[model samples]
Target: MRLLLISNSTMAGEEYLDYPKNNIKDFLGDKPVKALFIPYAGVTVSFDEYEAKVKAKFNEVGHDIVSIHHFEDPVKAVEEAEAIVVGGGSTWNMLHLVHKNNLTEAIRKRVISENVPYIGWSAGSNLACPTIKTTNDMPIIDPLGFDALNLIPFQINPHYLDKNPDGHGGETREDRINEFMVVNTDMYVAGLREGSMFLVENGKINLIGKLNCRIFKNNVQAYELSPKDDFNFLLK
Candidate 1:
């Protein structure tokens, strides 16, 4: 299986997808691919607008994408897609639509069994995990099920922050993750900081970008891992 799970789409003071455009280009290779884009997570923006923005970025990198909403049979679209790209927004709405369209299994089979390259950021990245329990978004709508694509064995907390803002008397991100660990003791959760991402291909996993990823597991102290360190252990 091949996956490019990004922590977030944009960095502060940067254009949308500006930081990862080259990474996306490199991952797609010299050959241009017209990947099928999943824009279900979008709520505030229309699918046409979302696809246009993403299409512009991919076009800048010599690739292109067509949103799945344009297709009548979404499953067939997934089956015939050369690559799949999922954009970030509301994970709840995304999963709700995905389940409503019966796309979970089709996507799973396409990426896991057929070796299609899968790229996702933020909420899209969350869908790559075993469940969306690690998402930072509020539960605005029912996701129908907590389960996600399960493309990766571990969970990813995207846009992970080290501390809460000043004067905020709420649980820190770590505290919430600690609560999650109490029940899901067997799973591993990676606090994927902004501007960071994980690359998984051919049974090996690597961390990208400068920021270190914070790892959490039950009974073990949460730790930081730099890009130079081996992340393949998380695959197990």
Candidate 2:
């Protein structure tokens, strides 16, 4: 199975996952590609509309777009897909949707049993983490308990920013990430900037992106990766 976790929407628009389409060939070996997008977490587009747009985005990226499905009936979608890509958005909102649709176990089972390639960005990346304790977005709503699919043992704060120049200056993204680490020492935190990705191929973890991926343990900097770094601990 292969898992691609991006920090955010690829290039910042509705076609947010274009970069992965170009680079995914590097990891797929010779297997044919089939992808699914879960847009339940996004606030803007309806899942059906997002599905249509994602297909176009896939074509724009030059991949043979097999199908683009929504999250309402994800199990059926997974059954028909060889790969799955969940788009970026609010982590809390996504988790709420996941719980609402009861898709956690279904997705995990497919990834673990069927070896389906799983791809996600931002909120999707956060879902791969142990829990959703490091998102920098305002807590507009809470699902009571912020949890995740635990695909990786560590906690991941995707799209991590060191500074937000909006003038609020309340707290840097790094500071919020650090706050999450204070109570969860057993879990590692990956502070990924935009364009960053964590890939799991054949169950191996590879850090792929343009920026350094900051690793934190006990609220301390454990290490950083510029690009194509191996983070097998996440897979372990």
Candidate 1, residues 128-176: lDDT per residue as tens digits?
A: 9999999999899999999999999999999999999999999999999
Query: What lDDT tens digits, residue by residue, belong to model 2 across residues 1-236?
Result: 66777787666663556677666655444555656667766666776676676667665544434333333466677667667777776777778877766777778888777887777777888887767787666665665477777777887787777678877758777676667677776677888888777777766777777789888878456677766666787656
Where does candidate 2 have its weakest 10-residue lDDT segment?
A: 63-72
Each candidate's TM vs. the true structure? Answer: 0.99, 0.84
Best by TM-score: 1
lDDT to native, each model: 0.97, 0.70
Angstrom error at residue 9, model 1: 0.6
